[model samples]
Target: ASQQFKENLTLVATHEKKLELKRSACPKPGPGQALVHVRATGVCGSDVHFWQHAGLGPWKITDCTALGHESGGEVVAVGEGVTNVSVGDRVAIEPGVPCGKATCNFCLTGQYNLCPTVDFYSVPPKDGTLTRYHVHPAGWLHKVPKSMKWAEIALLEPLSVCLSATLRAELKLGQPVLITGAGPIGVVQLLCAKASGCSPIVITDLSSERLDFAKKLVPSVNTYQVDTKKDAKTAAREIVDVFTNAADMGVQVMPEVTMECTGVESSIHTAAYATQSAGLVFIVGVGKDFIQVPFMELSVRQITVSHLFRYSNTWPRAIRLVAGGVIDLLPIVTKTFPLEQADEAVRHSADRTKFSVKTLIVDGEE
Candidate 1:
């Protein structure tokens, strides 16, 4: 009976085209795993990228792949040897399942985000949880507070990313921070920064609509709308001017901590340029295989450049932050759609004009 009623939406590819939402039977949890009846799954930017671009960077989607990672739901059943949680526990799923072998440097260091054997959900060749029911490792499920909504719980994944970035930069209270790209992750970083007591948070983006949304989410964040279509040099010059002027007024400009959330080369360069001498620059965005860094300037200024992969050891902190009312998630959820309308939801997420910050695929109504 469990196998008979299980249904899932899969991404299938054809000779000439690709199709998403082709349904199939649900899966059972293997050993040390749990089957979750998905209540809410957020449509992430990476999900949209998979739906449209068919892959992310080097990972290719050659076969049917489910498309969701940001999700929260109730545990329905657990496999043998599981004791951390049980049926009916509300949870926020951490999407990455890393190999915990002690031999691996990443695992040994507790930086499992960089584990070589990491299998991330919603990534190509790996089925994700954009369905009625899904299975995940028991250890990756983080219990959520009773007062938190499924929508807010779904944000834990993105929040983890921001937390990792902040942690990497050693973000401190009352420190000025500059974030590039006010997209979903960028805006979430702004929220996390504010909640962590970082002051004078500033964000820049190409879309006025997105910048407006960012303002709505965190009014205290100073925002700038730049024309991305302009030449990279011109754009960088304008940003430099803005930073210099802000610095002149004794306002914290050229932030001590810079979170580069946009993968665009120009934005990365701008972020590097905008950082203060000897400041920390945390690169959170995934870009091309090779990027041209301003080595001369970087060396001259002695800036600290750090990179981020998927988050590690951050789910619990993210959940607590949202549960404790330190970060408000309601403003970031710009739209919602039923599970059956997942296709439309993905399309809306890809369209910036729709003001889509984070779209939710609702599997429950009540």
Candidate 2:
């Protein structure tokens, strides 16, 4: 059915640090776009980050815009030139769409994620898919296996980030890897690392409860609780000590790869220190504009550092892993809310005491 002139319920970020559900006009599909019946939308850290501060990094909410990007649903209608997917197809929304112009260097080279002109959902000017009906680029919609649940499809965006981190780190099989932060990203990284055959993986976080929960989520993962009071160097030394003794040869050693999922400056420093010489440090977290790095130590050790921006061509692999049961995505979701409670859902996502690892807003059931 045509969404034109149809009234729908949408969650909007109106005013300073406020989220409210409002009635809005449903969007109709234009050329190369499809109208989707948004079934599930996962609230992300960025969404909370935006709502808490009413902005993120360089982007601020100037106008009333919906807040949600990690989403998937059924295509109810397709516009002209849209043939990849059809009505009634269950699909995962990629969220970020670059200017697919021929002159755009980033898009032409298949590095669309790097395109400066990209319009990402829920990031300032672009309205997100928090409503019952939304129109999105047809190419950005990926059909999921029918067996995949709505929640899993919605979470594909974050899973893509985890896959990008794993790929950028160039994780080697059987190599010891260190991960900092047990938040959703860190937990997902743990899964990706294990799936890549990384052995003796170590994860750290400030919350002992989160660390314990990480172990419960992935029984094989070795978790450590970081002492926030201690300096990064001392914490790094202590973490390395555990690895030194756990080495196969019982010789002093450090992890070959370190994925810093926490944006804390201390965690970044600790990751650099815990990684062995000639190893790799993957900075998967976003932080301040500039961070102090131990350049001398990194240079002396010849450690390679890399960072990932969203993801590049990772959805297929992420989908297969989840659909094939190679990775269990459901465990990451700790709470679910209806669309009407989006404001509460965002608040719960930011409050650690609420025990919400991930919060989802189902389109209906309010």
Candidate 1 residue-wise lDDT, 1-366, digit = tens: 243345665433322235456776767788999988888888888877776776777777776677888889888888988899898899998989889997899988999989998999877566787777888999999888789998888888888888888887888897878888988889988887887787667789988888888887887777777776776557655665565565466653657788899887888887777777899879898878999988877789998889888789998888878898888887888889988888888888888556677888888763
lDDT of 2 by residue, 1-366 (tens): 543445777888864778888886776799999989888999889888777787888888886778899898989899999999999899999989999899999999988999989999998899888888889999999999999999999988889999988987888788889999999899989989999999778899998878988899989888779988888789888888777665657677789999989988889888888889999889898899989988988999999988889987888888999999998888888899887787888888888667767789897532
C-alpha lDDT score of every prediction, in listed order = 0.80, 0.87
Give me the runs in candidate 2 sitting further than 4 Å from their true place. 1-7, 364-366
Candidate 2 scores a C-alpha RMSD against the true structure in Å of: 1.9
Model 1: lowest-lDDT 10 consecutive positions: 10-19
Error of 2 at 87 (Å): 1.0
Each prediction's TM-score versus the true structure = 0.91, 0.96
Question: Highest TM-score among the candidates is held by which one?
Answer: 2
Write down the lDDT that model 2 would get. 0.87
